[model samples]
Structure formats: C-alpha cells, structure tokens
Target chain A: MGKKTNLVGEIIQDPKVKPLSPHLQVYRPQITSVLSITHRMTGVVLSVGSLGLASWIIAGAFGEQVFSVAQLIISYWISQLLLFAWTLCLFYHLLNGIRHLFWDAGKGLEISQVTWSGWFVVSSACVLNIIFWLIAYGFFAKLV
Target chain B: MAREGVSHWWYQRLTAVALAPLTLWFVWSTIQLMGVDLAGFRAWLSGPVNLVLSTLFVCTLFYHMKLGIQVIIEDYVHDHVLNSLGLIATNIVSVVFCVLTVVSIFVIVFGS
Candidate 1:
C-alpha cells in the first residue's frame, strides 16, 4: 500500500500527467472545429507547396534545358494529381484567409455566419478547382 | 520578448493583407503559364513590373509562412528543446529558400 501511495504520488507530480483540453478525436466534429483544423492543415500544405513554386522559378533561371526537364517531371499523372491537390489547397487557403480577415474586422463570429462561411469556403474551393483544371487541360493544352 | 507573440500575429495578418491581391496576380499568371515553355516563361517574367512584383510576392510569402508555421510548431510540440529547434530550423529553411527563389527570379529577369 505504501509503494502504491508513492507511485500515485509520483504520477500526480508528473507535469505530463495533467489534464489536457479535449482534443479533436474526443468530440464529434462540427463545422467550426472541422474548419479550424483544416485551416491549420492547409497552412502547412501551402508551406510545402511554396517549395514547388520556388522550384519552378529556379528552373526558369537555369535556362531551357533545366526548365524543360523540371516541366517534364511535373507532367506525369501523379505529379498532376499532386498539383491538383496543391491547387485545392491554394484556393481553400485564399478563401479561408478572406474569411479570417472578415473575422479580424469583427464580423462572422456568430455560429450561423461561421457555418455559412465554412460551407462557402469548401464549395468554392471545389468548384474553382474543377474549373481551373478544365481550363488547364483544355485551353492550355488545346486538347478539349 | 513579452511582445513577441503579438508581433508575430500582427505581421502574419499584415502580410496576409498584402498577399491577397498579390496572390491573385500570381495565380492568374501561373495559369497563363500552362502551355508556356522555358523561353516563354522567361519572357513573361522578364517584364520589369512582373519581376518587381514577383520579388515582393516571394519575400512576403515566405515571411508570412514562417511566422504562421512557427505557431503550429509551438502549439503542437510539447518538448521544450524540440520546439525551439523546430522554430530555428523553420526560420533557416525559409530564409534559405526565399533567397534562392529571389535570386533565381532576378537572374532570369536580368541575366537573360
């Protein structure tokens, strides 16, 4: 019993043992929570995506041979899929960014407004991605 | 350093404000590059205004990006030593990357 008491005491003393705020998995997902997490995630995605942008510019500086080589690699089906995902991330981040601006200016705090904007951001991003790729493969490639 | 947190937040928003329209131009131009070859891309970026705006955009972009991700690292990483290391790494990587990007843009726009 004495050893058990000491063990419990040690556990209680551990800083890592403290109760944490409820994390995402513990709660049923709602629009507010879902969008909040997505915002963080997409921010990370864009950070990595910026590297892709950098590579393109760097390729340009290296002249046609290097640029065309990089372009060829990006022309693969998997690369196109990744590019589409990056495009979705970009549009989502942009709209969500505006949503945040609306927040900073002190509008859209109401639950209804938040929900509406959340849906708007998601739908707009999807629609824009479709339209973008259509133009990409169609007008850009003159294939459609 | 008590004010450091708020300042990071402030600059994040400030850069976002600058980036909004800049991003629009960037996205539009990238779309316009769909069929553009290396020479064509060089010609497009060679314009004085394009070079200037792109330089501004790249700088502001990575600056805002570093600040934003710094918070994520701070929040999620519980180990004290690891958190600081993450931040330092993020800062170094972003600076190096932004420099490379800016240099490349400038070289293409001018040296060509």
Candidate 2:
C-alpha cells in the first residue's frame, strides 16, 4: 500500500506557495501577551478543577459511602498535591481575572507599568496561596 | 457625541462590580466551611442566607467567566470555526455549571 500523504506535505507540494502569517516565534512577549496567555492556561486549569467540584457535589448527593470514598481520594497524598496545584491555579486565575477586568475597563495596558503589575500579580498569587495553605495546614491542621 | 466604547466599558464595569462582593462572599463562605462534616456542611449551606448568597455568587461567577473567556477566544483563536465553537462551548458549559450549582444548592438546602 502507498504511504498516506501528510497534509502539510500536500500543501507544501502545491505550486502556488502562499506567504504564511507571522508566528509566535517572530514576536516578542509583552505584558499583555503574557497575561493573555496565562489567563487562558489558568482558565483551562480551573475548568478541569470544576470537575472535581462536580464529583464532590454528586458524591454528597449520593450519600455517606460515596462521600467517604471521595474523602479518602481527596485526602490521599497524590490527590492532596493535585489539590494544592489546583488551588494555586485557582488563585492565579482569580488574580489574573481581576487584571483582565481592569484592562477591559481601558486601564493598565501601558507597557512598563502593566508588565511590572503582571509580575506583581503572579508573584502575589503564589505568595497568597502559600499563606493560605500554611494557615490551612499549620494553624488549622487541616492539611488541605 | 455619544462615546463609542462606552457600552463595552460599561458592561465590563458592571460585571466587575457584581463580581467584587460575590467573590468576597464566596471566599468567606469557603473559609468558614473549611472543616465541617457532611451534615454540618449541609446544615450550614441549608440556611436561607447561604443558599441565596451562593446562588448569586454562582450566577455572577459564570457570567464573569463567560465574558472574560469570550474576549480571550475572540482575541486568540484566529480560525473562525474554532473560535465560534469555543465561544459556544464556553457558553454551554458555563450555563450547565450554573444550573448544576443551583441544583446542588437546592439539594443541600431543601432536600431532606
């Protein structure tokens, strides 16, 4: 049997070569660019995290047996790690969401200031997540 | 002259304004519910105030998420089909999640 033709090869083999649009590698990263990309990434993460919430709710509705199973899974070491990651994603998404709201309001798009603020928001989200986890695990001894 | 961008600006502002209190309440509620057992958690959520506040929070949160995600997809996804699909899927998922949240709240609050 003949080998299947790759789409890219077929397109490239065409006699009429169209000029391609500029790609990501051609452009420098700016604050808005970084924030925009990170926002989408965090949004995707949060979307996945919603599934965890859904599982909890459905388990709660089902009854205690299911809830106990969920509790065991959530309290497991690996699940705890994932939960910590999800919490960081949540905070990052929330902070960047606020930043996007500001930009949507026609503010904070200035090059220098926006860049610094973007960094600040990312850093603050990490720090705040750590503080929250510390309070949860240390003070409360909840380990979550 | 009527400002051309005022509508976009106002809508964004409205969502932001709504999200402020809702987000705060959501965080506060989460913190308060930290260590409660199932029945205890359900009892706390069963209150009229908590149920109502959660309803408001879920609605506002999904609305804000839709608006934010719409802009992101509009800006980044260059392919028309993919962009439209993303936007439609975002709307569908948010609506479904909103409904689920409300239903869960009712189950928690009203269901014995």
Candidate 3:
C-alpha cells in the first residue's frame, strides 16, 4: 500500500506514539487539590445561582403576582435547602477566591503553607456557612 | 511572557476584601425578606440603604464571577479562538447582568 502523502509529502511521519505524561491519576489527593477542584465546582454552582438571581429580577419587574409565586417557590423547604447549598457555595467560592488572590500576589506558594492554608480556607468556609445558616434560620423561624 | 507580579492578584484580593462584608449583608437581607410579602420585600429593597447595598452586592458579585470565570477559561480552553470568544462572552454576560441588576434596583427604589 502506498504511504499517505500530505502537503509536505517529503517529511516522514514518526509511527511510534509518544509516552503520555502522568496526570491527575498519579498524585495522592491533598487539600490543595481538593480546594482547587472545589473552587471550580463552586464557580459552576454560583453560575446556576446567578440564574436564580435573574429570575428574581424578572419576577420583581413583572408584578406582585409573579413575584409572589417566586417567593412561594423559594420559601419552600426544598428550595430553602437549595438556598443553603447556594450560600455554602458562595462562601466557599469567596474564601478560595481570596486564596487564589494571595497566590496570584506571589505569596503562600510554599508547599506546606499553601496546602495548610487551603485546608484552613475550606474549613473556615464550612464554619462560616454554618453560622450564616444558623442566623438566617434563627431569624426566619421567628417570622414563622 | 507577561510580567509575573502581584497586580492581578492584588485586584482579586481587593475585590474579595470588598465583597466580604457586602456578602454578609446580602445574606442577611435575603434572609430578612424570607416569607415577607411582595410589598414588604419591595419596601425593604426600596429603602435607600438597602438599595445601595443591593447595588454594591450585584456589582461586586458579577465582577468576582467574571474574574474567576476568566481565569478558568484561560487555564482550560487552549484554542485561541474559543478562549477569546469565551472571554468576550463572559464579559458581555457579566456586564449585562450587572446592568440589569442595577436597573432593577433603581426601578424598585424609584419607580414606585
């Protein structure tokens, strides 16, 4: 069989495949990796949350009836759970974002410190989210 | 290669620094509005302080989102055409959403 020719036909193509470099599979999971993955995950979550914001704006613009319907949906138990999730996502994204900012500024790139701080940020995000939900529910429970 | 210093990093830090308290206030305001009627919610939002906070929250939130999304696209999307398009689209959407959010705040605060 004739060899396949290309625009540059004189060049011989190498038949052997190059060795694939090690990727995510090779490394042990660590806090920095967890936080890095979570940051992107929460970014996506917040993107979805932005749609909720859009809905709120549109409903508010339309009229009271439409707004009330949205209010009803959002106030439901399941929706409240979603809101809590969204709130957590917000805080996580915010904390990790600050971490990224610090890294960008050429600080905290030390292996030990970076991983330690990543865990700290993640833990702080969880604690803050819990406190926020507690306060929100405390106020909300009063109104009910 | 572009210079490797802390300017971009500083901006992100600054944005997060500003957003910290603003986010807390936003969460509080949103919770306060829970179960309140439309009029009640509107009245709260219409108040000058709430309007200002809401405006700031929306603007900062979109700004942060834009910055984060831009970095993500730059890192993962290798194709020059796709990366540029994604960057542009992200900016456009973020700006439009910010404007819409601000406009809605104004309508709530002043339209009534």
Candidate 4:
C-alpha cells in the first residue's frame, strides 16, 4: 500500500479497531452541546455586529451630518430589530463566556452542575436583556 | 505550536475577563446617553474616564473577537488554503475595526 492509502487500508481491514465515536448528528440534543454551539453562534453574530459599531463611531467622528445619517438608519424598525438581537446576543455570549471562564478554572465540571448553569445562563441573559432595553427606553429613569 | 496554543488560550480568557465589565459599562453608558445629540455624545465620550475605558474596550474586544473567529475557522474550514485565508481575513477585519474605532475616538476627542 502506498503511504497515503496504507493507514486507510489497514484501518478498514482491521475488525478489532472499533468504529470511531458517533458523529454530531448521531447524538441526541442536550443542554451542554446546544449551549456550546449557541456560544459559537453568538460569537459570530457579535463579530459581524462589530461592523455596525465601527460604522457608528466612524460616522460620529466624521461630524454631525454623517452621524445623523447613522442615527436615521438606526431609527428604522429593521435596524432596531437587529440592534435588539445584537444586544441579546451580547448578553448571552457574555454570560456563557463567564461560564466558560469557570470551566477553564476547573470548576463546574459535574454533569448536573453544567445543566443547571446552562439554564441559569439562559434565564439571566434574557432578564438582563429586558432590563437593558428598559433602561434604554427610560423606564427606570422615569422611576428615579 | 504548543507554546502558541497556550498563549492563545491564555489571552482569550484574559480578554474575556476584561470584557465582561467593560461591556456592562458600555451598555450602562449607552442607556445614559440615549437621546443625546451628536455633540453631546461626542463630549461624553471625550471625557477622561469614558475615553480611557472606551479605548481599552475597543482594543480588547477586537483582539478577543479575532481569536474567537480564528478558532471557528480552524474548526470548520477543512481546506488548507481556505483555512489560511480565513485566518488572514479574521486578522485584517479585527485590526481594521480596532484601528477605525480608536481613530474615531481620537478624532472626536482631539480633532477640530
């Protein structure tokens, strides 16, 4: 067998070598994997969203005319919806990221703890998002 | 390779720690600045504390973002050429965004 095909041929011929671990599709969806992928998804969203942030700042720097243009775009409902999603993504990523930090420190390795923290992260992120929007709209400010 | 991997891991976590508070502060500041005009917003950002924190936030954010996207590309992009290209793109995007942010902040604070 040639160098490239030698290992493949041997692996195919050997019955004793058990099949590799199941593919991602084979696994039943669980909190751990779901949240893991969600973290990546949110990261991607925030990465793309950073472009808007840079654009906003650049407009502000360019002076009032450009800044107002940005503000006008932002006032659109679609832009507002995107901003809402971005903020929610921000909170989700931030919370899940802290969980990751804890995991890196050798904490929260238990299965039960992982599941509990996963739910906690989701709930807290939602709550924080709501509070953020409230504050943005002056809901809290009016009370003070 | 191992040394580089370790350094990457270390920086990702370190920046994550730094970003947590900075992001929260940013959200809070945004709330406070709601409805302010361009001049008012610029004036607020140019203040000493906001300027420093905003600078740190932008730098750390883009660095962290670059590292995260690099991992995603490494994980999913199977072809060697594409993987390398993805990494390059990630680096360029992050650096450009960071520089743009910092320069904008500088111009707002110091430029006429």
Q: Quote each prediction's TM-score.
A: 0.89, 0.75, 0.79, 0.90
- The candidates, ranked best first by TM-score, are 4, 1, 3, 2
lDDT of 1 by residue, A25-133 (tens): 7899898888888988999999998988799888888988888888898889998999999889889988999999999999999989999999999999999888888
Output DockQ, candidate 2: 0.31
Tens-digit per-residue lDDT, B1-112, candidate 2:
2573576556756876776667657655666665456787688877888878877877776776776677778888999999999999989988888788778777766776
After superposition on all C-alphas, the RMSD of every candidate to the true structure, in Å, is 4.0, 6.2, 6.1, 5.3
lDDT of 3 by residue, A4-113 (tens): 66787764455785656777788998787777888898987897698687668657866789888988898899998998899889988878777776787799999998
Docking quality category of candidate 3 according to DockQ thresholds: medium
Q: Score the docking of each candidate (DockQ).
A: 0.73, 0.31, 0.51, 0.73
In the range A1-144, model 4's lDDT, one tens digit per residue, is: 433335446434356656677778889999999999999999999999988987888888899888888888988989878989999999999999999999999999899999999999999999999998887877987999
Clashing pairs in 4: none
State the displacement of the C-alpha of residue B94, model 1, in Å, after optimal TM-score superposition.
0.8
User: Chain B alone, TM-score of each model?
Assistant: 0.94, 0.86, 0.89, 0.95
Question: Please, what are the lDDT tens digits per residue for candidate 2 over residues A62-141?
Answer: 66677667767777889778877877877777787677777777899788778887898889889977877776565656
Which one wins by DockQ: 2 or 3? 3
In model 3, how large is the Cα lDDT of residue A135? Answer: 69
Stretches of model 3 off by over 4 angstroms after superposition: A1-22, A101-110, A139-144, B1-10
Inter-residue clash pairs, candidate 3: none
